[model samples]
Structures are given as structure tokens and as C-alpha cells.
Target: MIDAEGLSIKIGAEAKEFDGEARFSRSQLTLWDRVTQMAIAAGEEAVQSAGLELGDEESLRAGAVVGTSMGGMHTLDENYDLIYRQGKSRIHPFTVPKLMPNAPASHLSMAFGARGPSWAVTTACASSNHAMGQAFQMVRSGALDVAITGGCESQLTFGVLKAWEGLRGMARDACRPFSKNRTGMVQGEGAAIIIFEKLERAIARGAPIWAEVVGFGASSDANDIVQPNQDGASRAMRAALQDAGLGAGEIGYINAHGTATAANDRTECAAIRHVFGEHADGLMVSSTKSMHGHCIGAAGALEMVATLGALRDGVIPPTINYDEPDPDCDLDVVPNEAREVEIEAALSNSFAFGGLNAVVAMRKWRGA
Candidate 1:
């Protein structure tokens, strides 16, 4: 089987504290491009981790996949400024290229000289998860010896903010996942990338095995464009568990799709309990969005990277800002601060708008 080897994350140049406290610097690009930069940084880091030379002709077999939710809104906004206010005749030639959702994948391919196949997969919030899943299948099918994959997004633009404001699901102040006081998700932007290689190839190359992709599950709610369907999400989770050849009890941790929205948190909790029954509570569950806010398409890759980090460091990043717990989401949300534990196998869950549900199962790579 193709194994996902090194997983890495690079927060955007305009870094924010894990706590959704405040902006550290005045952001320049649309939150999406900044996230693309983050994915670039992480991809470079992964290359370093894999000890592979970039732009090496030998890596022509390497491919790339990146996902983004809203691409180039920042550029669009700026171009509009020129056209309306400044009365510009024509937009810049780079406008389409920079604003395209596939820009991140294109940039990654060019930067790494990955010549095999490159593409961007978009499924709203499930964008990155779908991209990663596609890359996994490519590796498994022996299309390529290696692949660099992940997602990046920056939707915290003026236009995006206005659009999200219309949604009315965002919090007025802080994001509180699984908390009774939780209002909604605070906007976030970032990117993350992971490297995947065939397991035997990785061992042969003496690559560091961070995690193994045992299973992946994807499904569509086909119910609503905005609201989530618990049944669809539950079915996806079960399918992932089955693909992993795992039972509900075998999963020790669940990186939940706890977006902190009133509907999402409650619905996701129900889905988990429905699928896992009594074993649901036995698993350590938390939403890192409490610290990072809701980073749209990049959220899933970042969460998966966090899961790998948890496996590597033996520490679970806390769901900060979780003060009052919700009875509905009644699970041990490794609340605030890192927690130490043995996480043999963990699941990262993501359910996006339009009823897109993607679940990925990862096992800590133990040399066998």
C-alpha cells in the first residue's frame, strides 16, 4: 500500500497565535493566497523532511494536489478597486492565474518541479480531504512513486467576511466549540501539506514514516448546501472504519468536525454517538478550530497534520476557549493545553457544506 509519510504544516507568513485572539500583522493577500503560501512552506518542509532535492529531474514521477475553498477573492477585490474607483481599462494578466483556485497546486508543482500530475480538488470544506484522498489512490494505484498533497485557504477577505456575515452562523466574538456558550466559527486562514509514498518504497528509501493512511471514506449528503446531515456523516465514518478494517472501539481518538456552529456541533456529536455508541465516549475527541478558528478548505489537512503531530509528539493540541461544555457534545475534548496519551490509531473528520463528508484514518507508522 502507498503510505503517507511526512506530514508538515506552515502557518501563513502572517502568523496568528493559536488562540483566535487577534491579528499579529496587517494581512496583505486575500486569506486564501496567504494560506497558499502556508502550503508552499509546508511542502518545502516536507521535502526537507523526506531528504529529497527539489527540481530534481528524478522527481518527475512526483505529483501534487492542493485544495482551496475561495480562491483569489483578495485579488478580485483589489481588481474591482482598480476598475471601479481608479477607472482602469483592463485587469492585470496575472489576475486569472493568481485568483484561480488551482493556483496553489500550480505553484506547488512549479516550485517542486513535480511533473507527473497536478490538480486542485474543490468540494467546499471537503476540498483538501478530497484532494488528499485522490493523491492516496494515485499512490496506491502506482501512478506515482510519491505525491505531495494538502490544502490551503484564506477566506478572511472583506468580500469573504461580508459573505460569511450573511451566513449569520459565525460567532460575534470568540469561537467556542462544543461549549454551551459557543456561538459559531470564527474565520481562519492557513495551509498544510503532507507527503505520501508507497510503504515499501518509503522503507526502501529509509524515509521517516510519520503516519500510515489505512483508510479513507467520502460521501455526499445530497440534502442541503449549507446544513450538515448526521446520517450522511455517520455513514462516511462507518465506511472509513470498515476500510481501515477497524471497529469503532479500535479508534482511540477522533479529530472531530466540530465547527462550533450550533447545528454542526450538535449534529456531528449525534453522528459520532450514533456510529460509535458507548465507545464514542471512550475516544478522545477535540476540535483544534477552537485555537485556529475555522480555516475553511485547509481545515481538514491542518487537522490531519495535527493528528500526525499528536502521534509524533504524543501530545494532543487542546481545544482552547472551551469553557462551558455542551451536553450534546459530551465527550472528552482534550480542553485547553496539550495532553499526553497513546494514540495508536486516530481519525480526522471533515463535513463540508453541500453535505460533503470525508473521513480519513491514520495509524502511527510502526516499522513492521
Candidate 2:
């Protein structure tokens, strides 16, 4: 669980500082914001796991796409505090570089010496899903052989927490998604990354395949800014199924965009029902948000990792704080405990506050 006490807020799930020494040299660390630092750490881990050490020429085709909704929040907050609160005239000269939305992605590309198609996406909560989706398409189109893609967010500042509190989404208790007693959402901050490569290349290199990315779907509601729409979500799921060429029955599990908010849990359930029909009753859907809290822009990447991990180990993580059931969100949430289930195919959903939606389809990876 990433959210715990002792944060600046009433409650939050925040990534702790590096357990050991810093990930990079002291001189290098001074230039990077926390978001960039997180992206570098996550991107390096993914590249290392893929067993990819690229030559100079080959690295040109390798790329990165990291997502962040609140890029360089820590840097911006600190600088603002220094200028306004402290009555200072001067600010850090590197402020512009540190606060750019693309800084994290740029850092990832430089860290891996990847020169192709490096970028960032900032779609509120669905940022990482869109970033990874685009990366998957690049690999499919043969634009790049290897890519580092995921998301990082560190928005636990006092100012941001106060802003969220104004929005009234902060849960008084725990984040009990799909539950009757659910109050609201809790914030979390962390990064999760994945490495994507061509299936043929991975097979030739004998790289371990954790899961196969079959399809990605995206949609925009163009409706309310904060409220979600069922039609848009259903459309994305339908498109993902079509892209994957899979029947609804083929999907056995779903990693839901369950925010523990009353609106999201109910709306997401309705979308699933509309898309899957009778199969919705049989599907196992759960929200890991109950454990990790809402990671905002990084939520999709973390949930995708969780979903793939579930597929690999045949262990579906649970919705931990489910005390009571809400009829509107009456999916089999795998409430309060982990379950052992071999899932053939799974879909991870990410629906953002702006009514933007993205979903990806994955299947359990066997051997080549």
C-alpha cells in the first residue's frame, strides 16, 4: 500500500524517498525534479528487466514516453513558496527545465540513449494509459524496437493537497471502493514503468514475456469536465475488444478504474455492464486503489503492472477495504482479500476526470 499516515495531508499514500543512497550522482540529482528522478528510476528498471543493452545505432530507434499530470509539482511549489511567501526576488535558474511536462520523458530518453519518438502525455488520470498505448502502437508499427513507457507523479505538496480538499474528494476514512460505506478518494504518489518490444524481437532475444499487449482503446467524452460518462467508457472498451479481436467472454478479469468515489464506481460498473452484457456477471473485477490509493496520473501504469502481475502469478489482488456492498457497483470486487485465479485475458481501464478514457487488453504470456 502506498498511502499511509505521516504525509502532509490528513491521509495519503506517498512514495518514500530512496531507501538506500540516491539513484543518481549528487551532481546529477541537483538538476532533476522528483518527477524526472522517478521516471529515470522506473525507466532504467524496465530497460534492465527487458535485458536490453542497445548499441549506438540501435538506440536511435529505442524511445520513451512517460506521463505526468502534475509535472514538477515539488519544484514549482517550492519555488513559489520561496518567491511569494519568503518575499524573494530571485528564483532558481533551472525552474523552467524542471517544470516542463516533457522533462521526465526527456530524462528517460537521455538515460537510455534512446533517440526515437520520446514524449509525454498529461491526460489527468489516464495519462499513463495513453502514453503506454502510443508506445504499443509504435512497436506494432515498427517505428521502434524497444520503448520505455509508464508514468510518475509526486503531487503530495501542501498546496496540492489543500486544492484537492477543496474539491471534496478526500476520504475521511479509508478508500473503500465499490462499498456502501465509501466516503471518497485518497491521494497517492509513485511511478510504474513497463518495457515494450516487438514480439519477434523478444522471442529472438529469449526475453521473458510477462504478458502480451493485444490492443488499446481510447475515447473522449466531450461532456462534463469532472463527471464521467458511461457511453464514452463503453465505446473505449468496445474499441479495445475489436482491436484485440477478442470476444467479451475471453476476458476473465478486469483491473477497474475504481476510485472509491460514489460516481466512479457506479459509472464504471454501468460501462462494464453495457460493454460485456451477461459476461459482466461472471467477470472478476477489483480495485487495487483500496490498497494503494489513487495515484492520479500514475494510476493507470501502477494498475497495469498489478494486472499483469496477477496474470503472471495467477493471484488477483483484492479490494482491501470493502466493508459493505453498494448495489450500484455490484461487481465481484474480490473484496478484502487476494484470490488465486488463472486469467487468460484481462483489461485494465483508466478513466480520467476530464471524461477521457483509455483501456488496454492483455493476455497471459506462454512460451514462444
Which candidate leads in lDDT? 2
Tens-place lDDT per residue, model 1, 173-269, is 6778888998887778888888888888789878888889888888989899999999999998998888888888888888888888999989999
lDDT of 1: 0.80
* lDDT score, candidate 2, position 286: 96
* Decoy 1 TM-score against native: 0.89
Off by over 4 Å in 2: 1-9, 17-21
Question: Which residue window of length 10 is worst by lDDT in model 1?
Answer: 1-10
lDDT tens string, model 2, 276-335?
999999999999988888988889999999999888999999999899988999889999
lDDT of residue 348 for candidate 2: 94
TM-score of each: 0.89, 0.96
